[model samples]
Target chain A: MTRRLPDPRPQVEIVAGRAHVVGQQCAACGLRTTLVVSACPGCRGELAPVRFGPDGTVWGSTVIRVPVAGRTPPYCLAYVDLDGGPRVLVHVKASTEPVAVGTRVRLRGDSGGDLVVELVR
Target chain B: MSHQAAVLGVGTSSFGKQPEVPLAQLAWSAVQEALSDSGVDARGIEAAYVGSVLGPFGSAQRALQGLGIGRIPVITVENACASGTTAFHEACWAVREGRYETVLVLGQEHMSSRITGAIPPDLGDPEGRSGLALPGVYAMAASRYMARYGLTLRQLAQVSVKNHGHALGNSRAQYSGDYTVEEVLASPLIADPLTLLQCCPISDGAAALVVGRAAARRDAVRVRSCALRSGRAWGYRSEHAWGFEIVRETAEAAYAEAGLGASEADLFEVHDSFTIGEILSIEGLGLAAEGEGGRLTESGHTALGGPQPVNPSGGLLSRGHPLGCTGVAQLAEVTWQLRGQAGARQVEGARIGVVETMGGGVAGLDGNACVVAVLERP
Candidate 1:
């Protein structure tokens, strides 16, 4: 009998085998943010959690050549502008392919509760 | 009449590596110079505000403790790279509100002692945990800006060439040499589209300024306005990268307070921590229209002798970015220019100038903090 481990990130939920990201919208000012907080960042109003799509567009990207801890060199980082939601920073899955602005992307999450983006041609 | 704050004197230590110097010693160097330059005794300073990014928790108290300036109120400011200017802003407020007759503002940083390359964002931040370093973040913005505006890489490299060329006249600059656009393009790449020549070096240095009532110093420069703002949270819509919105709003507020417009300023000293950073800043500050900053640089509109000269003191690109020191250093350069003391690189007959400095990176937010200050010759 294996004990079920609690998810590490509060903003991420595992439904069946798929992962979905969550955020909060202010009850007063309509301000939205990716982090889970009791009060809204804008108006300090009560917030309710809302789920966002696993799809977004690559607003911008960069190829980092410098060595980073626990990460491979030359990995891509992108600002993924989600559909009907706020932007998020995620690691691009492509190792060799170049990423550009406005490239459509599909968000994917790992068991570790980390999000990454896959470029859609 | 509202109490007014005037800049009595300004001082800056040579910016670059100084591994042998302690943080307090670096601060003292600038403080002593400022005291001498202002012809004001240390005993006259009623309070002190110190700014630093990586300095210890009690760094401000430690900086003023051993100096024998008595037990005056001392406070430390930590607002990322904007720490220096933020300290200056607080000092001005103290003088304006009549809480203190005279105040000392100091900024110091020792970047060369520990880390290298672009500074990392806070580990607890979502973006930082995603491994978004400063260079990578700027590169992403640069890529989007270039694509949106049809800017060429050659045009972008020209900014580095121009700033490095400007640095050749200043002895305090970190990296200074006349280089062509090709040389800039050929330099070792840090992030895609950004090369070694385009990034600010890790440096150690300090700067100091004295703010007092206008009647206290007849030769002082006037602090027309100083505006500071933190980033606003993202709403339902996604915004552009690089925090342009905050820059614009802060600049507008500063200009409104000063009763001036962007076109009225004869010179600008901005945070050019990266070549692309300057492009974004100038545009957001209204020095150039959107998508026109690169073109403005290429056309010589932002050159030393141009109509709207910018970063005549080499900026952070070549003058070195000692985080906390960069902001106050900009004001010092402006003060010199306004006083007609900037011998070689001065904007001819500069009477009005503006300084803009920004700092910190939090994901999903426009920016952490942005400061805009306007100054005029008294």
Candidate 2:
């Protein structure tokens, strides 16, 4: 609508979590971006980049029958809502079977060095 | 109004998972149409710009080989869904820059290959190396928009229904028939707010566009502007800051260059990779008021005969997305509309048209790259 107005407030802090996600907060509007972002897409606020805090419940998920570039079929992926409230989409770490929506997931790094979510304790 | 980009010719092939037809054969069909449409010989052109999402080894040259279009300098351009549009941009640029008078633009894709099935080991930096897929990225975007805006699943389903109906009239589109909103809602939910119908199908096809400088009558549509840009500053903590917001930002510039506002444009051909994407694109490009795109769809503003007809060829929704051919097809569709060539799906007395094609790996906040162009017949 409005040309991506700048993010008036920018906040990002990398912290410890099962799987890390970038944290975000707006200073001007006090809007909290549930996921780590570079800028406030709504406002032109420059975001402070950081890692995600782990311990999220599955907001939703699906097993991808569509294969990855070099991977096998039935790749597990999901959107996890952190215990702290931010939601992020990610491929759950490797497992033998598919993933379900609402599965409790722990965060961890994947083979490529990106933060990943997995079923955990 | 005579800045000088004429639609010399255009061509397109039926869209689908036609693995039976080799990639070159797919390109050849569109290429031949463009040459014949413009009434020009293949050798009359000095250069070529081919847009493709995924091509197997010198694919454009291979496709042209069948047409005896060898010995001409050809370059492949890849810009995700905007691949075709990107090709158009380069051809127009060549004309504007006064390098060549006759240039060919093409957009094509062949997703039926192994590329669609496996992740490229060199997809991207560490972020992608860790394994991030497009569906999840868009799914995340859908989730955030729904949660914050209170957009309902029913509203999202309406998008698929509307687009499905639009595609029904497109003889070249892959999706057919009318679907009820309820039926869409009842379809399998691949993502939280997105159903299977909401997403565009993987396709293999190509489209050719012939745009060059030529004197014409007052009715000729000139290439008003083809503004391409990458990166916009959006401040969101949870937003995917990885890719650029090229579509919205570039569309803004393109509108300015065209000496018009988004409202002045009569029709739009945008990249509807996912149905929700259409909503976001309209809002992002200033075509609709923010938080009002979905409502516009519900209100029938994006229908074929509405104030603004979007994706008349069923867009990527009904029209199959062949990477390289998409942009050419979009331009051809727009040209036909401007020339009053679109039959059943034609927007009566249409004059101005705009196209938005954005592609690349899905990131946290926005599309990776994009190209937006504005055209008019005066």
Candidate 3:
């Protein structure tokens, strides 16, 4: 019998059945960041974990043709600005539809707990 | 009154593949050239600063060891691509502060052996997990630039055509040609709207500078100011964040230090690693008004011999983006232009010159690091 390997963990924690990306907000300076840090880069304020949008606007995006991290060619990537103030990087699903700036997108959780973005047609 | 620092000499190795030569030897070649150019012997060097990213850890010690420079205070800088100018900034401060009379700054990279399409990202960052890299980030910017300002693909290709044409006169540049805009557009696309010709090729090269106190040499170029800024990625709140804010702030600081404004610059050497990069950087640096960079280029305002020529050295697009070497190379080119030494591609009567170098990118940040400086002919 072959042992099952685990999927890669999500970059940010997600509550069960919730389709939102987690972010951290500085309690003092009100600065928000998608990446987790002990102290705020702005004012050295303490950070508290917060949940951001289930949707966002695609600020900028590209479909990489070269192989990246065992991922096949032609996978889409985007800098998605959440409905809230935070911005995060998301892997868009493979589709013929063009992903341009300002395109609306929704977040979905994969089996690995990673969030993938889908075009909200 | 503030102290002054001057660049006494500058040197650079041929910027292309040099796998047959060791990294230290490549650095020593540039070092020897700098020592000869400055007419200052190795004995005159009081301290050294080394800048590199992927090279060996103690590359400074190894390079100096190969050059037979006896013990002197050496510090290695690894501020991404800004490492070279970062070293130069530290050297200028030392000279101005009276800590060292003369210092050497060297930036070297060996991309021929260890680099390919895009640099791999650390998995610790979520963006890396999402497979976001340099090309993708810049591509996103290109897309936004196109959407926000109505910039066309043809207009962007013109930058490559112009820079490559300028490189024809530069014997040290890795790539040179008289390509047309159509040709640039026809090249294979690396990222959307950015073709092969539109992206800077990776190469192995080295650039060195000798900086000293005021009036150090007969033809030294005065270091008016050097300013650096790191990313406030987490704090920045904008969908259109293309790292321009950092460039703007850094440029403002440098101008304040130099007691001048963008209008005072006769020429510029910007971080044009990609076509859109030049467009965004020039605007951010205040060379052109916001959202007018592409229009300015289209109008031939940024070309050589224009009111204010930019990247007369062909920039990273044609000169090759050898990482650590790029920033210091900008200084060398600007120095030559200011001293009336840059032939063929020189911006005539260039008095005030600006050099901007930026590097490193993380998932949420605009840019990991940036360096900007102003120089005057002396």
True contacts kept of 3: 0.43
Arranged by TM-score, best first? 3, 1, 2
Candidate with best TM-score = 3
Weakest 10 consecutive residues, lDDT, candidate 3 chain B?
B232-241
Q: After aligning candidate 1 to the native by TM-score, how far in Å is the CA of B180 from where it should be?
A: 1.3
lDDT measured at residue B108 in model 1 versus the true structure, 0 to 100:
85
Whose lDDT is greatest here?
3
Please write out the lDDT profile of model 1 over residues B155-238, one tens digit for every residue.
Answer: 789889888888887888778889999999999877777888888888988889988987877788999999999888753363
> Where's the lowest-lDDT run of ten residues in candidate 2 chain B?
B235-244
- Write down the C-alpha DockQ for each prediction: 0.42, 0.13, 0.42
What's the C-alpha lDDT at position B85 in model 1? 90
Rank ordering of all candidates by DockQ, starting from the highest: 1, 3, 2
TM-score of each: 0.94, 0.79, 0.94
In the range B1-378, model 3's lDDT, one tens digit per residue, is: 346899999899888777787888778888898889888899999999878888777877888998888689998888887889998999999999889999999999888777665677555566666566677778888888888889889889988988998888789999989999999999987777678899998788899999897667778899999999987664237534477877888999999989999999999999989999898889888988878888898888888868988889899999998888889899999998999999999888899999999886666566878899999998
In model 2, which regions exceed 4 Å deviation? A1-121, B1-3, B115-131, B214-219, B232-245, B362-365
